[model samples]
Target: MDILHTLNIASSMTATVFRGGAGIATHPAGAQPEMLLELYDFEGCPHCRLVREVLTELDLDARIYPCPKGGKLFRAKVLELGGKTQFPFLVDANTRTQMYEAADIIRYLYSTYAARQRPWYWRIIEIQRLLSIIAGLPRLGSGSRARPRSAGPPAHPLELYSFEANPFARPVRDVLCVLELPYILRSTGCPAWGASATDPAPGSRNRARLQARAGEISIPYLIDPNTSTQMKESADIIRYLLRTYGQTENGQTKK
Candidate 1:
């Protein structure tokens, strides 16, 4: 399918969810950490989506290990570390902390990294839960199934430039989740201010810089350092993943 078509589908899937990190609360000052935060989750999970939305609102970066159902690579890692398959599991190497549960994770993020005043929207935890579940309906079960084969894992984690509300990014993330490939999430949300100092629109400098570095502004962009392959478009990325990693000894995607 075309990129525009894919984006349209993604947008339709996440209609109720606010875009550009609206309504979510954020810290006035950025938090600097010694180590990158690690998360094990599937892109299609409502719970995981909540955490990622919060991450984007806070403008925090994370190392993601996709844990789609029937996945073999990171699923075992989640089991080893957390002793369960439950996700949105977070590990803070700097603080030596590992945690599960969406509500708890949200609270921890605010207290540890955000300003003292948390967003009122987040206070309505139940509402957030409901909305997240609603947002997840479009892509339900897309990332849960396992393929019959396996591609040997890469040496280094891949990198993805995306924001929570992006539809194209969602499908790419889903594929990664099912494949259990770990990656660095580079968020690219809209700017808070306009072009001028007095304007409120966020400037384009940051996004422009990222695009210049990557050679494109369109997201769900993937960079595989191990293979030195960087590309855009979700469908193409999915195809690449299947061709590279889909077949295992049993001729099935690893489950």
Candidate 2:
């Protein structure tokens, strides 16, 4: 990797540390929702990061609708659904519930799916939120706002195998968020404390699936069904996304 890219990954690692590695470990989930959960939030939102961490912890996959600031698309949908533009809005179609507030979302996910209560520190709402904000500072608002798109959204939602705190994965997610591309986030992380010591944790179904499908396990692995493309490497993914979807102000795809 180039020096600049290496530095970017280092900053992303710091974001994980600021949150004390919340998304690195997994917990058991009790029930699976019939339909995929939908999350309307920007990647750069501190509160959204908290919810994403819980998602990784519980290994729950969700369809992410990136609602970055100045985004013209999904932001309006959030307003129509929740009556305001406030985010980290979660729509659980199975339960017919749509709501905001990161703390409440974490509680609901744990209670409904994880079959347990949230971690103690997560219950300390204000303090946790404060720390999340600190964690997000290293990102320099990369995923907080929208960027131009060369074309409309793809017919099929892209698939991304990612864990919330994966430094290599974060930049890919940032580009997806900025372009407001909705994607199925397959939350993948270590199933236990030392799971990383093993190449693919025996307990990690996502990792197993990735290995079986791609012949290896690495993230953030992106599958763009729109173009029938699947690949690994964060920088390569970013470049492909820009070439395929991203646009400059003048409406040409960035090369």
Candidate 3:
């Protein structure tokens, strides 16, 4: 990564630390998914960040539909389904529940999937929300703009193995959100083994191992099952998405 990019990521990580890692801890409850939970949210929204952190803490995974501001797609779907543009909306296929607001969603996730006892720290939802907003200020207006192209939809939903706070992965998530593509978000959290001096960071070694299992050592790795394509690097992923799914200059498919 270039120095600037590295600094940007480091800055984001610093923000999470300042916020006391509010949304980063795992729940005593374990992973349990009969059918994937679905979330309609943008990457940079503070409200959305709260719910995502809970998902990571709970060690659960979900199908994410990126709903960036002014996104032509998915935003309409949210209004059609939920009657408003408010975000951090969640849908649980297992119970057939749909709702909005970050606090409500976090409570539901804990009640439905986690063990009975609630964490006292999470009771301060409003405080967390405010801090999340403060935390998001530096990365303002990112992952919120509409790009000027449209590629055709994929034959299958792509898969992204990532955690919410990875600086390298966040930009890729932003692009995917703006395009409103759905993907299986496999959360690769910290390693079962401890961190080391040679490691990229706390979870870097595990992320690399998981990527290697999928045939790589880098991230933000992407796998397009539709085209049998897989690659690493945020720039390449964005270029591929625009080339494949983004509209041509004439406002139609490239080909």
Error of 2 at 230 (Å): 0.4
Q: Measured by C-alpha RMSD in angstroms, how accurate is candidate 3? A: 4.4
- Model 3 spans with C-alpha error above 4 angstroms: 1-11, 22-28, 191-212, 215-219, 246-255
Put down candidate 3 lDDT per residue, 28-115, tens digits, no spaces: 2443769989999998888998888877666567889888887776788899999999898999989999999998998998888877
Compared with the true structure, model 3 gives a TM-score of: 0.81
C-alpha root-mean-square deviation, candidate 1 = 4.2
Candidates arranged by lDDT, highest first: 2, 3, 1
**Reference-based TM-score, model 2:** 0.94
Q: All candidates: CA RMSD in angstroms?
A: 4.2, 2.0, 4.4
Candidate 2 lDDT, 1-255, residue by residue in tens:
478778888889999889888887776477667899999999999999999988888888899999999998899999999999998999999999999999899999988997777779887989989999999898888899899898888999999999998999998999999999999998887777545523443345688788888888798999999999999999899889988999877888887
TM-scores for all candidates: the values are 0.82, 0.94, 0.81
- Cα lDDT of model 3 overall? 0.73
lDDT (C-alpha, whole model) for all candidates? 0.70, 0.88, 0.73
